[model samples]
Target chain A: MVDLILGWTGVVLVFIGVFFLFLGALGIFRLPDLFNRLQAGTKATTLGVVSTTIGVGLIAKGWLVFSLALAIFLLMTNPISSHALGRASYRAGVKPYKGTNPDLYAEKVKKESDQK
Target chain B: MRIEIPQFIWIAWFVIVSIATILATIRAIVGPTNSDRAVGLDTWTTITTGFWVILALYFFQYILLSVSMVYAILSFLGVLAIARYLERGL
Candidate 1:
């Protein structure tokens, strides 16, 4: 009975992960610009992985340590990478979206704000 | 503690992640500029890390977890490398 329950839970968790992954991909493809695409890709993928990993760990039994470590690693590093990508893209002179509400660059705020 | 998840579920998980990777690939391909592609690639790498963990689960092997750190480090260093390159180019 316990095995049955664990197995069923695993199936559910796996499905959830897949759903989130599909959402991430959809966001990546649908978003208009690099910034938004990056946002979609990182956030959704991280969450999806968390769900999938936990599910797998529980189903496999005694992998709790590995899953916990993986979750921590992903949560920490994914954001840092996202930040780096954003900074690098900005430095590379990629233009912001035309519909942007504020033009910090136009106000000479780019450098000063960056320094802060 | 009895758990017996079907193997097919793991396979399904793999399929979904692969699809995500493919979608990321599309962004990388249609990226309007170098930076756009770089960001796309970064996102792609981040997803790939999770992929490794899933692979480990599917195979039910503890040793594979050891390799996960490598992916983590690569994703970390890859971004920093891009940052340095972009800064120097500016």
Candidate 2:
């Protein structure tokens, strides 16, 4: 009975994960600038991977450890990499989308150069 | 091989993911700037990681899980390297 329940749940989780991935791809296409693109790519894909991994763990015996570790790794590394990509793109002079407010990064960079 | 569920589910999953990948590839190709392409590549790698895990589960081969893990690390490092290069041109 438990196995049957797990199998169904796993299927549902996989479907949900795929939905997030679909949205991520859509966001990439629709978003105007690199910053927004990275935002969607990182956040949605990370959640998708996490849920899918855990769901797979529940469905398969003896895979729980591997799946949990993968989930943790995804959580830890994804955000860091996203930040790096965004910062790099900004520093490399990829212009922000029109109407982007705040521009905190620009102010920080200016402050740092002035400090030096 | 006896299976209770419809095998087409597996095919459908792969097809959906493949479509997503193709869309990402389109973005990469049409991306006007280098950073856009970089984001595309990053998203592609991230999607592939989950895809490999699903493949491993379907084939009942556990070793592929470890391979996926290694692939994830490699992709992460590669993106960081590319980002660094893009940042300073070094």
Cα deviation at B41, candidate 1, in Å, is: 1.5
- How much does each candidate deviate from the true structure in C-alpha RMSD? 2.9, 1.9
Candidate 2 lDDT by residue in tens digits, A10-87? 778877787777778778878999999999999888887777777777667778799899889988999988899998
Per-residue error at B76 for model 2, in Å?
1.0
Question: Candidate 1: lDDT over CA atoms?
Answer: 0.75
Candidate achieving the largest TM-score = 2
Alpha-carbon lDDT of model 2 = 0.84
Error of 2 at A46 (Å): 0.5
- State the weakest 10-residue window (summed lDDT) of model 2 chain B: B1-10
lDDT of 1 by residue, B1-90 (tens): 535556776677778888888887888898888777777677677667767777886676877766876787887887768866875542
Per-candidate TM-score against the hidden true structure: 0.86, 0.93
lDDT (tens digit, per residue) of candidate 2 on B1-90: 212447888888788888878878888899999989989988898888889888887887889889889988988998899899998846
User: Cα deviation in Å at residue A77, candidate 2?
Assistant: 0.3
DockQ per model, Cα:
0.61, 0.60
Off by over 4 Å in 1: A105-109, A112-116
